[model samples]
Every structure is written in structure tokens, then in C-alpha cells.
Target: MNRPPELKRTLKNRHLQLIAIGGAIGTGLFMGSGRTISLAGPSVLFTYIIIGTFLFFVMRAMGELLLHNLQYKSFVDFTTDILNPTIGYYVGWSYWFCWVVIGMADIVAITGYTQFWWPEVPLWLPGIICIIILLTLNLLSVKLFGELEFWFALIKILAILALIGCGGYLLITSFVSTNGIQARISNLWSYGGWMPHGWSGFFAAFQIAIFAFVGIELVGTASAETDDPTTTLPAAINKIPVRVIVFYVLALTIIMTVTPWSMVAPDRSPFVNMFTLIGISAAATIINFVVLTSALSSANSGMYSTGRMLYGLSRNGVGPKVFARLSASGVPQNGLLYSCALLLIGVFLLYAEGDVMKVFTIVTTVSSICFIFVWAVILIAYLRYRRLFPEAHARSVYKMPFGIPMCYVCLIFFAFVLYLFSQDKDTLTGLVATPVWFILLTLFLPLYRQQLKKRISYTDSKHNH
Candidate 1:
């Protein structure tokens, strides 16, 4: 007799840590922050803080639930155990859909970044190149994925540190920019004061701000393949707050300090703008390359997670069996190919729309909305776990603080963000587009569940042999 194949726990502590960091700092922070800054003014700082704080609680809830049962591969599994199997099926596929939407946005962003260097190049060319490269890298092995993320994250970190360090130097020396704007801490408040746009502007920032944190749960998905779940999972989860502060809050603080909120262009990246204003001749090229990789890193993560989610769903008979097959390297080859194929549609969008930011905004809004649903599912699962197994919650080594109350609070917060999305015309399109996915899922669910039962029975009989 032979044993069945399974996911390898080849991801080490370093891989896990860097993946966590990479997930925290997404393409949105680079490509979308300029718009958020424009919308919220200096108070955009508080927007990141507020969103990060709530999501920290969400991650804590997720960490506690995932650590409680090692057999539970991801939140999808726990949703099945604590919630219902039907809802679990929905969450699993929705999560896959969430990543696909994000992958499309990344595709658009990569094209936009590429045009910075080669203005004459077609937009679709860069996206196609990126997909092929990511597909090749991801098909090799999960460790290769980890290694890719580690280097990608390192690049992002060094880039930010350089920005912070350079911005800090400008502030300390009161160095004047080529534009004649002198750097100073008071630059944040001097232009328009904090909350310049008042609460409406602060609240408006939530739509894009939420997109920045979409992949924060990538750590949870990777936990099943992690080397030591008990140690690395908690370590990664706990640092999310600090990562959010330094990478998002602190970096933006410095950017606004050197370049006032009024001066930061909504369409261009403030990171590149900061460097260009400080008279770095190659600023646009350098930061363009960084952001290009940042989008690639995000798309790479999308490839990895969508593959695994598909593999997870297939194993439980919720998806097609072909997706359940793994390559010799223990990678989900079929799933990877399937997702990559769907991503090509994004290239078509780029050709059709001929506008990157418009496509980026609409797709990202859809991604953000779906992610909120996925996070809500985790919180619901946690509440159920507390009800069914009080002793388990009591005995847990890593407990979610204020678990019950915070669950409700996070749920309400997500709903509020959705409401914010509806108010804007651009985000409103995304808000409208999201329900189509759920409606289609509801329509086909019963047929899929019927097939699922048969598949499960056949597998059980084979094992009995």
C-alpha cells in the first residue's frame, strides 16, 4: 500500500516571516497611496492606523482559530468545522475569486509601471510578460515561491528604508527641494493641518485603504505549509501591527513631511515623486522598477494562494478533481495553470480601456469588497468555536483577546467600509459588481454539493480497500 500525496511543510521560519512582511506591504501601498493621500490629506495617516488596528484584531482572531486545530489547513477548513460545510464551500471559492480579482489588478498595475520606462510599449505586453514569468516561477515549487517572496520583500523593505532615511535627512538639514519647498515636520500640518478635509475626507480614504490590506491573510493560508505552525504562526501574526505602522504609517508620514499633502499628486506615486522632487535624476526609473516588482510580488502571491485554495477545494470535492493533482515538486500545477489562464483577461481589459487607473480602481474595489466578506467568515468561525468548544478556547495557548466583542466590532467595521464604497461612483461600480459572484455561486451550489457527496463516498470506499 502507498500513502497519498499532501502539501509539504517546506516553508521555513525565514520564508514565513518574509512572506508575512511581503503580504503586509502590497502593491496598493505603492500604486494606490497617492490617491488615498489626496483624498484624506494628512489625516490619511489616521486612515491607515484605523484600518490597520481593526485588521490586527481580525488577524489575531484568525491566528487563534488556526492554531487551535492543526488539521484545519486554512480558514476554509475551520469555516467548515465551526460553521457549515455549505458556507465553507462558499468561503473557499470566494477566497479564490478574491485572489483572482487582485491578480487582475496587479496585472494592470504592472503594465502601468512598465510604461514609465518604455512609454512607447503597448500596455498588454508587460502584463503578458509578468504572467509568464510568475507562472514559471510558481510551477517550480512552493519553496521557490517562498524564496521569490523573500527577495521581493527585501527589495520593498530596502526601498522604503531608503525613502525614510532620505526623507529624514532632508528634514534634519532643512534641505529645499528643486521645487523650492523646504522639508520640515510641520509640513504635515502647515499646508492644511491634519484632517484638512474633515471626517468626509478621512472616511473616503477607507475604500482604497482597505485594498492595501487585502492580502494580510496570506500568512493564514500559508500556515498549513509552514515549518512549525505553533511558533512561526504566532510570531508572524503578532508583528502585523508594527509592520503596518512602520511600512504604511511611518513611511507616509515622512513622504508627507517632505512633500506636503497638497503637493502630492493623486495619480502618481508619492514615493517616486519624493525622490524626483529631491532631485534624484533616476528617481522615476528606480522607483518604477521597485513598484513593478511590487506588483509582480503581489501577483506572485495571488498565483500561489489561488492555486492552493483551488487545491484545497478540490480535495474536499468542492472543485474539479483535476485541480487536486500536484506536480512532482508538490506544487498545484493544474490550479496554477487555471488561475494564470484567467489572468489573461486582464490584458484584454488594458487593451480595451486604455486606462490603467480606471481599470485598477474598479477591480480593486471588487477585490476589497470580497476580502471583507472572507474576513467576516473568519470572525464568524471564531465565534462559533467559542460556543461549541469553550474548553478549547480556555486551554488555548494563543487566545484572541476580547474575542467575542471584537468579533462583532470587526463585522460592523467591515459593513461600514462597504457602505463607504457605495458612496463613490468609481467604488460604487465595484460594489455593484461583487454581488454577481455570490448570486452565481448560490445558483450552482446545490448541484455542486450533490457531486461533492458522490466524490466523498467514492474516495471513502477506495480508502477502505
Candidate 2:
């Protein structure tokens, strides 16, 4: 019997490490932190810590599940097994849609980022060019995808490190900016005493803070392509705390310390502003290039994830079989092409209306809501796995600590965030738009099942003849 084409496990440990790092840091940290700080004040620090902690546990559960079976392609596989095929279909498609929406927003962002350097360039042109370039790279090979993400993630890491280093130097020397504010640790508390906007502001910050962690789960998706899941995955998951602290908590602390929360502009990137305040005259242009890479990195990850997810869906008979076809290089070319084609819709929107940021907000909120659903599904799947297969859970080498209890905590946290979304008109619009996606998936399931049955019957008949 001929086996189906499979993805190559050519990704090394370094690739996996950088991919995990890249996933944790997105444009949200670079571009969106200013808004979060403005809304929640210095308390935004706690917002990130709390969210990152919960998501760490979520990733642990996913790690345990993925390592339990090497044959499992990703979370969507076990989800289908532990739950039902119908749910598997919804989760797979929804996950794909989540990245698709994110990719669209990132492309729009890329256009805006490019405008900083080339003011006359049409918004849609850069978006179209980026999509094409990323598409070509992804279609080549899995190794190539891993290599690109490795470098993209490295740039982001270096940028954050430079910020922390520069901020530290300013603080130790008590450097005073042209604006007359002295760089010191007390800036975090001197102005408004941490909770500048109070608890209400802290709670509101979750809306934006959660978006910063959107791609943190990409490590789980890469499990299939990783060289050794058992060793590499645990190593990757164990470092979540340190990564969250250094990249998110410590980095933000440094920013707020050097410059008071009050001085940060909500409409602009704090990263660019921080450098400019410290006398980097060309900070705008330099940060623009960094942010451009950040956006491209995110869009690149989105394309990779969407392609793999579609392939997983097809393998399970939930999507068209054509999506399951692999190129000579073991790349999911059809899936990649389909996802990129859908992403062109963003370019179309840019042509229709020259408002990239408006589209970005709507799509970002929608992506965040979808991610919450996907996380909840993982927890639910974990609960089902523990209940149905106690022996397997007992024998598993990598166990999720306080697994059952933590699942509930994460769920409640997600529900609270969803409620927070209702408090704002823009986020509320996204929250409302979420159900339409699930409803569409629900309506299509029966038809999908019928198609699967027909495909099976035809395959059996051809084999027998």
C-alpha cells in the first residue's frame, strides 16, 4: 500500500527555538504596547504577566497532548480523536481562519510600515508584493520556511535587547531627555503610582494585551516538523516563563522605567518613541524597518500555519482533498496558494478604502476572539483525554502540572476577556462577528460529511475493480 505524502522533519532545534521565540513576540509588543500602557498605565505590566502565565499552562497541555502520539500532526489531530470529527472540523477550519484574518491584518500593516520610507507608494502594492514573496518562499520547502522564521525572529529579539540595554544605561546615568523627564526606576510609580488609571484601566488593558500573545502557540504547530518532539518540545515549553519575562515583562518594565507612562503616545509605537526620546534622530526610519520585519514575520507564520492546518483538515476529510496534496519538496503548495489567495482580500479592501488601521483593528479583535475559542478547545480536549484514557495519561512522560484545575482557570480567564471585549464598541463588533463564523461552519458540516462518504465509497469501488 502506498502511504500519503508527509511533511519532512528537517527543522532543527535552533529553528524550533527561534520559531517559538518569534511566535511569542509579534507586532503587538512593538506597535500596540503604547495603547495598552495608555489605557492601563503602568499596570499594563501585570496585564501581560497574568495573561502570559495562563497561556503558559495552555501550551503545557498542548505539549503533553502532542508528545503522547508522534503520529498526531498537530492539536487538531488529537482534538478529532478525543472529541468528535465534527468538532475537529470546526477547530481545524477556525484555526485556519484565525491565521488568515491575522495575515490580512499584517499585510495591511506592512503597507503602512513601508509608507514610512516611501510615502508615494500605494498601500495595496506593498501588501500584494509581500503576499507574493512570502507565498513563493513558503511553497519552496519546509526547511526554507523554518530558516526564514529563524532570522525574522532573531531581528525582533535583537531589537528588544537593544531597547532594554539602552533603557538600562539611561536609568543608571539618570539621563534627562529634552522633554525634561529624568530616566529612573521611579517613573513606574512616581507619576500615578502604578495603577494610574485604577483597576478598571488594568482590566481594560486585557483587550490589547491578549493580542500580544496571539502566536505563542506556534510551537505546538511546529511539533510535527520538529526533529524530536519529546525532548525538543519540553525544552521549548519549559522556557515560556523566561521568554515571557525577558521579552514581555522585563522589556516593558524597562520601557516604563526610562519614560513615564504619561509620556507614551497611544497612537504611535512606544519603541520608536523610546529611541527618539533617547536622541536617536533617525529612530523613526530604523524602527520602521524593524516593524516592517515584525509584520512580515507574523504574516509569514500565518501562511505557514494556515497551510499546515488546511493540510491537516484535508487529511481528516474535512476539507477538499486537493489541499492534502504535497509538492515534490513535501510542501503543502495547494494549501499555501489557497490561503494566500484569500489574503488578497486585504489588498482589495485597501484599494476600496485607504484606511489600513481601521481594518487592522477589526481583524485583530476578530483574531483574538478566535484564538480564545481555539485555546478553550485545547483545554476541553485535554479534559476529555484525561477522563477517557487514564492509563495513557499516567504513563505519559511529560505531564501537565495541575492540569485539570489550570484548565478551568484558563477558561474563566478567557471568558472574562470576552466580557471585556463587550465593553468597547470596536472589540464588541469583533465579538459579535465571531458567531457568524461558527454558524457558517455548523451549516457546512453535514454537507462535508456527505462528501466524505462519497469519496470513501468511490475509492473503495476503484480499488476493488
Candidate 3:
């Protein structure tokens, strides 16, 4: 008899490492940093550090929970098993929707980036093409998706390294730009002495900073496909601090030191701007290509995440059973197709609105709010693991440090971030609109429970016959 289809453990250690790195560094760090620096001045560096520290704990909790049972496909699976099935239903679907929104925004972003090179092309065309390309790649196999992300992430890693290396050289020589601003470390404090806009601006920076880290928990989702979860997951989670330092802290410091925080444009990418300011017009074009790939990488990860999330939901009877079926290549082909089809809404939005920036803002804010819910669910699930599975929690080798306490701390931090969202009109719109999703999920949850019960009965009756 043929074996039932399942996700394969084909992802290598290097794939997990790159995926972790790619998740931490995204378009938010590339494009949104300009707004962050402009709003918080040099103080944004501290904001990254603070937020990264708390999120690291969140990752630790997830790592421990994932390693506790190698059978769990993703955090959503454990969330359902440990918590009430209803809560799991909410988190799994919400996490899937989070990526769906993020993927749409990324598609819109890819269109905008392509227009930089081809000014006359219609925006929706590039988005549609990108979706098709991503769909083809994802439908092949999970390993192929990992391989593509590995290279996409490698490009971003090299780009950041290049920026830091060049910026360091400029700072060392005190090189002056064509605009006549001298590169120096003092640029960090000279403008307005760190916290330039006071505590309020520093707090405001959290809204954008949190969005940058939206996909950081992707490793949790990739657990089932990883070759060696016990060693690989903890190793990847532990290195988050180093990644944050080199990718966000060190990279941003170099950019600010080279160009001064005041000169960064809120609407443009700081990576591209830094290259242009230093008289390397060619480098700016190259960086644009890199940012374009960065957007693609994010969208690619979004695709992988949505498909896997839907598969997990389907296995638990919350989603259509079709999504649970795997292809001969050991991939969730149906789930992948459904995700790509939903993502076409991005193309529609582009064709309808013709204002990529406006649409991107609304979608990104909504995505961020949804991500906050998902992260909160992970922490809550971790708490339940500690109380309900004390033996397993105690025996686990990769136990979360300061487990319950840290979960509470992270939850508190999430609350503060949500309050920060309410402080801004753009993000507040997303915050207000996010509840409709939950209300809708609540309404449909009972129907899902009924379906699940019917399926269970049918299976039992067939087994008896």
C-alpha cells in the first residue's frame, strides 16, 4: 500500500539558519527604517535592541514547546493540542491570515520596486508575474522553497555586510559626502542627543519596529520539515541576538553615522539612500535590486507559511480537508495554490487603487496587528504547557528560561506595543479593523466544531463496518 503523504524532513541546518536570518531581516529593516530614524532619530537603535530582547524570549518559549513533542507540525498544532481546540482554531487561522496580509503587502511592494526600474509598466503586471513565479517554485517541493529562501537571504545578508563595511571605512577616514556631511560616530548624538523627539518619539518607533520582526517566528513553523529539530531549533533560536546585533543594530548605526539621522527620508529606503549619498549611483541601483529581492524573499516566506498553516488547520478539521492532502513531492500543493490565489488580491488592489503606498500602509498595519495576536497566542500556549504538562516541561532539554515569568513579561510588552499602535492614526486604523477578523472567526468556529464532530463520527462508523 502507498504511504500517506506527509511533510518531509529535507531541510538542512543551513536552510534553517538562513530562514531564521531572513525572518529577522526583511523589508521593514530596509524600507521602513527611514521612517523609524526620522521619527525616533538615533534613538531607534535602542528601540530595536529592546524589542529584539523581548522577542527572543518569545522565540525561546516557542522553541521549547516545539521540541517538547517532535510530532507537532508547528506552534499552531501544539497550541490546539495543549490549549482548547477553539483557541487553536483562532491562532492557526489568524496566523495564516497574518501572512496572507503580509504577502499581499509584499506583492504590492514588489510592484512598486519594479516600477523604479521600468517607470511605465503597469503595477499589477509585475505583481501577477511575481505571484506566478512564486507559485511555480513553491509547488515543486518544500526543499526547493528552502533553497530559494537560502539564496534570497544570502543576498540580503551580503548587502547588509557591504553597507556596514563601506560605512565603517567612511567613518574611519571621516569622508565627506557630496552634500558635505562628514561621517562620524558623533552623528548619533550630535543632532539631538539620542531620543531626539523625547520619550514619545521613541515609543512611536515601536509601531514600525515591531512590524520588522513580524515573521521572526517562522522557524517554529518550519520545525516539522527540519532535518534535526532537537539541535537545529535551539541553535537557530539562540543566535537571534547575534543576528539582531549585526543585521539591525550594527547596520542601522552605520547608516546613521554615514548620513546622519536627520537626512534620512521617511518615504525612501535608507539602504538605497546611503549608497546614493556617497556618490555611488550604481550602488543605489544594485541596492534597489537587493531590496526588490528582499521583498520577494518576504513574500516567498509568506507563501510557505500560509500553505503550512492551512495544512495544519485542515489536519485538525478546522479547514477544508482538501488542504490537508499532500502531493507526491511531499508538499501541501492544494494549500499552496489556495494561498497564491488569495494573494492575487494584491494585484487587484494595485489595479483598483493605483496608489501602492497608500494600500501598502493599510495592509502592513493590519498585518502587524494580526501578527501581534499570533505572538500573544504562542506565549499563552507556552503558559498552558507549563501548567498542564509539568512533567514534559520539566523533562524537556530545551526548556524556556524563566518560563512562566518570561511569558508574562512578553505579554506585557505586547500590550504596550498595541497601545503604541493606538497612538498613531495609520496603525490605529489597523488596530481597530483587526477585531472584525476575530469576530468572524468566532462566528465560524462553531460550524467548524460541528464539521469536526461529523468527520470523527464518519470515521468511527466506517472503522466499525
Which regions of candidate 2 deviate over 4 angstroms? 1-3, 354-360, 450-465
Instruction: Quickly count the clashes in candidate 1.
Output: 0
In model 2, the clashing pairs are none
Q: Which residue runs of candidate 1 sit more than 4 Å off their true CA positions?
A: 354-363, 451-465
Candidate number that wins on TM-score, 1 or 3:
3
lDDT of 2 by residue, 1-465 (tens): 967668999888888899999988988898889899999988998898999899999999999899888888888888876766677788899889999988988887898888887999977799989998999999988888899999999999999998898888888889898778888888999998989889899999998888889988899988789888888888888898899999988888988888899988898888887788778989888888888999999999999999999999998889988999999888999999999999998787677654665756776677789889889999999998888778889999999999899999999989999999999999998888788888889888876887556655654464345
lDDT (Cα, tens digit) per residue for candidate 1, span 1-465:
856677888999998999999988977787789999999998999899999999889889999999998987888888866776677788999999888978887897788778877889987798998999889988987888999999999999998888888888889889887678888888999977898888999999988788788789999988889879999999999999899989999999999989889988898889998787667889888888888888888999999999999998887768888999988778899999999999998898776654665766676677678889999999998998898778889999999989999999999999998899889999899899888888888987876778656655654464345
Of 1 and 3, which scores higher on lDDT? 3
For model 1, state the Cα shift of residue 312 in Å.
Answer: 0.8
- Local lDDT at 182 for model 3: 93
Q: For model 3, how does the per-residue alpha-carbon lDDT over 1-465 read when each residue is reduced to its tens digit?
A: 989978999999999999999999978898889999999999999999999999899999999989988989898887777765677788899888889988888888898889889999987799989999988988898899999999999999999998898898889989998788899999999998998899999998998899889889998888679989999899999999999999999999999999889889999888887677656779768887898999999999999999999998998889888999998888899899999999998888876644665656766787788788888888998997787778888799998888999899899999999998999988887788788888998888776978656655664464345
Q: List the residue pairs that clash in candidate 1.
A: none
TM-score of each: 0.94, 0.95, 0.95
Candidate 1, lDDT over the whole model: 0.87
| Regions more than 4 Å wrong, model 3 | 354-360, 451-465
